[model samples]
Target: MSVNLNNKKESWYMFKIGLVIAFSAVLAACSGGNGTKNGEALLTYGNEAPTLTQNPKQLDLLIFGGTAGVGLETVKLALARGHKVTSVSRRPERMTLEHDNLNNVKGDFVKSESYASFIEDKDAIISAIGVDASSEKITIYSEGMKNVLKAIGSNSSTQVVTITGIGAGDSKGHGGFFYDRIVNPFLLKEDYADKTRQEAILRSSQSRWTIVRPGFLTDEISETRYRVLLDMDGVQSGDISRADVSHFLLAVVEQGAYINETVFLSN
Candidate 1:
């Protein structure tokens, strides 16, 4: 019988990788998971991970693009938590979620003043905007962020938390192996360029801020068990549900945590 040594070695290596991934998942579950790469929590500011304040404040949240996606999830979550929620949408009539605490404002995201003037009174302003561009360069994120920064100015006490995605800033190459090698370079370069510009606008601004970078978004239910990574080292892009993304967005403001930092959320 003829044995192929290279094939045997390749098979063993592949199997080892599979076992390591499985073991990591089991270990993470058994350990209740650490928020960081080496078993330390990320998003620390006088505490481990972002936590609810000992006495949580009923937040006044103004959300841009709140009619859809993560923005909609955030709006729904905020209302459920008894917070005063203002949803800025291009078409307010399209917003189906309603509560006594919910206010629907009609306006384009690129024109912040037209809708978010109530920003001055809010505890936090959450910008959850994105674009789908194939031909024209996308500017909705940067442009909207510019208008938001202008409206926010230098005096408003509103803490800002903006959600960008996996391919922005220092997070440019950390969306696991396949995404970094294929999806990002081939598909999302233009979108991510604008997202990078959006990040720049927030970093250069004077407002209190936290930028969340969630991995490939799914429609799955929120487990609230995702990993929060502040460092790209040893971090792999994983699936995180949009519901979980909203949860982190709310936590950042309600708990008054993850300020001035960029975090990557994955499961």
Candidate 2:
């Protein structure tokens, strides 16, 4: 009878051990099957590669008189927007703005070859050149513009965007008595006459172009708000800050919305 009892006890112990083993196997399977043993941990055991997006191509731009007051700031803004820029100026040494894609070249506007190399591979050109209004200055505003345009047209498929006065060319007499009678007769007759001829040159060029006619330019800060006059109407009749004018020049280039069109901007 004692022998029988020992056999029964051994059988019971084996059963208990088997049960424990099965329980452990179940726990292991459950831990591996679920994302986490509990609800607190994340499972990254078989994560695959992440999806990627393609980046768009960037445009290249060239600036004439880029070191000038408003033009300098325009360069900074263009660089910030990821556009590659080449700045050509009489005093190229004054360009202190640093950017990986910006190039500064020195040249004379009247000599096409001087700026020919710089505009060779450029996509577009912004002529921010300004001449002094002194009566003794023979290279009036229009003459300077003509020289710069001639240089820009020398090479590559570069489009041009340039700024001239509001009462320039056919845009004259737009500001009523203030611009026609009072302003142009005294302060701007010589300048306006030259700008008129300049506009004619730009219009007749084979290269794509835009002539920006702005009224009574000032060094004041911009409100970022202005109007665009497609026709001659409402032009030569309003005021715009130089900052805003530069902004418009760069903005129009990027958008390509105003191609082969003449825009007159004002407030």
Candidate 3:
């Protein structure tokens, strides 16, 4: 049988197109297709989190203390990713990044009424609350988180990601010898104490919570390989960029990963 050259080329082209479509369908499913789940439009494949998500579901996110270090970084990245982000702070005007999906709202996390109005409609709330390490007694981490939990009463669907430092919780003695003995004791003693209280609040709260403990945060860009340790066995504080932490936070909320668990991040 003699094959027609033009007809043969057409058949091959059609076969290639079919393969492309099949590959794309599987990729879409694995990459979290443009869909919703679990009443809040989350991407759910399995309990384990995917590191790289290509097509993330657009989320309604309320960032309590969104003007803070990690919170501010998350707001910028979330807006860039086209998610509807409500960046809350006492001075929201300080966040000059404007986007169609961005909503700058005046809110003080210390008061429930100040930010409760905004939490009702959010899919997740990232409490990037932090306080300076000082000799003075610190209670903002605990107090503010208490107000946050109150605002999100009975809303377990609203995934809450709270940022605490490495010296908090079981990661206490992991901030390096000098840092754990000197810096943490003399400087961050009060701050870490409050952060411990804050973690307790979230763990006992009604909201689905994931507590994130980032190691020794720095303004320097992260050029090293990122490390995420769900089990902090023998882990110590390492330098990680705020930028990388923001990326990790966004992933947690979007993928609905790490509920009821404490995660450690470093780079």
Candidate 4:
């Protein structure tokens, strides 16, 4: 009876030690990576990764092209987060967002003086300005960006985020063959050319800026779990919703990551 009791005590002790070791291993796996588990790289598509931190404070945001697409979504999201948003667009009445802190200003991208008053004392500026695919003369992208740069001259403290397509910058080949070879050259040739010029203007500007290149925007609901690739290499072409893009932009503003960096977004 004494020997059996001693054996049982030893077995219980070994089981407890094994359980502690297993729990410690799990903890180490979860805690060591950069917002990732089990040595996985964060921001890789299809990988379970931690999300970017959310910002809770109210901020003053000035957004251009706020009537449509990503711009409209950004305005809605910003207002929902209790931030003061000034939307600059050619048609102010088109912006249907009704909020106490939302202000819609009628302005043209080509003429910065028209909305220069709205840019003052803004915490951040988001430029979602772009020309349509049917546009033949694509000078609006660069010219509008130039106007924005001039409007915010020497204001390096204010964060600036610009939305451009995937083929805008050095991400020419990452959009797959249909986009890289045919669509980019034939369908969006003029538009992409001006977008490249737009990127150049932002790069040379002194303001702290982040250039977001989204792949094939769609109107689907936001998953809120998207990938941000800093470079074009190994990036797969996929469609991401405008809502997701807006979420990422707000995250960038709140988290202050990727400042002075160009990143590509995809689902």
Candidate 5:
């Protein structure tokens, strides 16, 4: 018995595709955390409230979760760049978009029905939802993300930029062994699990996706420009401001860099 060369190549490719699909399933199941299981919720931004800049345009931009912190900042940057925005959440707030290009939608990640109107015919989506304190009650980030991707896929042109933390998959340490084994394993295990799952959802989707994996997020803005590392490249960082991360999201949409790639942004 003998195998043809072309058959062998076909088998190898099929094996790789199967591996990717299996990984995607694992990623979709990783969203669980140790936060308060039930509560009204802490605002996405604790104290580092996002201040609105000018409006971008009046185009509909549906963002997931954050009303302050990074999510809010992401909206602000998008508005500043002239893109209209809306944020999907379970509890609708009275917050006003400082720019003319902003709107709001009340929705939840667990309910696909709620996300439909929010995503229909939108321009782009920038998700800043974090699995930090609110992780336990919600579905896995990737699961929620799959819902988002499906919604976008059914609708009009809608690009997506979803945020996941560093150490999400293999992006853990440009810092080497001590960081990978000790620091990441101890501090980021659960979040990374969810993140990896979320990454899988986005990567598998047909939507134009950019997974922004930033190093430790902080409230501090920098005078110097930050760096972007994509394609399994390693990047280490002490911190990156939520502001910078938001800006990076907007910039990528314009440059079309990092599309269908996992990019790590660091200080």
Candidate 6:
């Protein structure tokens, strides 16, 4: 039997078209339909937290002290990652981050009724409460944390991340001579005392809490790559950007890696 050249060419052409269609379908499935697949939404800039097993999740995040510092950065990063964020602060109008997923609430952290309602059904809570270095007597840190703990009572599934200083808990010696002996004792004595109390409150709670102790914070751009010291025995205080610390906070919430643990952050 003689083979028909035209017939063979048509068969090959049809096979090529079929292969192309199948390949395109696979790419669409992997990339997700409508930019979401199996509850994973397309992320911007990928996963900021390198430790996470998957892309960052869109969570209902309740942030205290979100007007400035690391708290502000947390709000921005969470919103950028498509997370629904509710920032509770005394001055909600001060939060300039305009995002469809961002909600600003005017509340006082020290008062349970002020911000406690926002805590219900929240996936995670990030507390960046702090006091001035020159504060003679400080109760804001401890009292605010106390209110948060009370509001989150018995919610073991709710993840909580709190930012304290290096000299707050067992990491006291890690701040070097100046921070440990002088700055902590003189400039931050009252503030550290409240932080110590705050840590104690968090430690006693049954919730999945992670306390972050970031070394001297700066306003520099984020390096993202920073050192996380689970043990502060031989560690020394270093500097890290507020942006990096906020990134780590979101990562911890996403990965749930450091549950019921306190880790020191520096770069």
CA lDDT scores, all candidates in order: 0.77, 0.65, 0.75, 0.77, 0.63, 0.75
Q: Can you give the lDDT of residue 65 in candidate 2? A: 80
Q: Which residue pairs in candidate 2 have backbone atoms (N, alpha carbon, C) closer than 3 angstroms, thus clashing?
A: none
The residue-by-residue lDDT of candidate 5 on 1-267, one tens digit each, is 887987776676556555545754664366221111023111221122223335433556788874777888887767667776777766558444555667777877757798786677876777887654221233458778877777667444577888887577776554334446644554446667777888887777778888887765668764325556544432344356888888777766655556677776655
Give the true-structure RMSD of model 1: 10.3
Candidate 1's residue-wise lDDT over 130-173, tens digit each? 66533237888899888887887787778988999878998887
- Count clashing pairs, candidate 2: 0
Candidate 1: give the clashing pairs.
none
Report, for all candidates in order, the number of backbone clashes.
Answer: 0, 0, 0, 0, 9, 0
- Over the stretch 1-267, how does candidate 2's per-residue lDDT look in tens digits? 247876776576556545545654664454322111123221222122111123324668888788876678678768877789988788999998878989988976566677777666567778777765423324444665677666655443667787776677777777544347654555556666777777787787777778777655657786655566666643335456777777777777776546677666655
Higher-lDDT candidate of 3 and 6? 6
Q: Candidate 1: list runs displaced more than 4 Å.
A: 1-55
Q: Give lDDT tens digits, candidate 3, residues 1-267.
A: 887987776676556555545754664355421212222222222133236478788999998768768888899888877799988888887786878988899977788787777788678889886654455578888899887777777755889888997788898987655557656665568889999999998898877899988876768663435566676565655667888788888888888888888987765
lDDT of 6: 0.75
TM-score of 3: 0.78
Off by over 4 Å in 4: 1-55
Q: Write the per-residue lDDT of candidate 4 for residues 126-235, one digit (tens) a residue.
A: 98976655325688878988887787778547888989887787877666554576556655677888888988988998988999988778798888766777756656
lDDT of 3: 0.75
**Alpha carbon RMSD to native, model 6:** 24.0
What shift in Å separates residue 91 of candidate 4 from its native position after superposition? 1.7
Q: What are the TM-scores, per candidate, against the unseen true structure? A: 0.78, 0.69, 0.78, 0.79, 0.69, 0.78
Residue 221 accuracy (lDDT) in model 4: 82
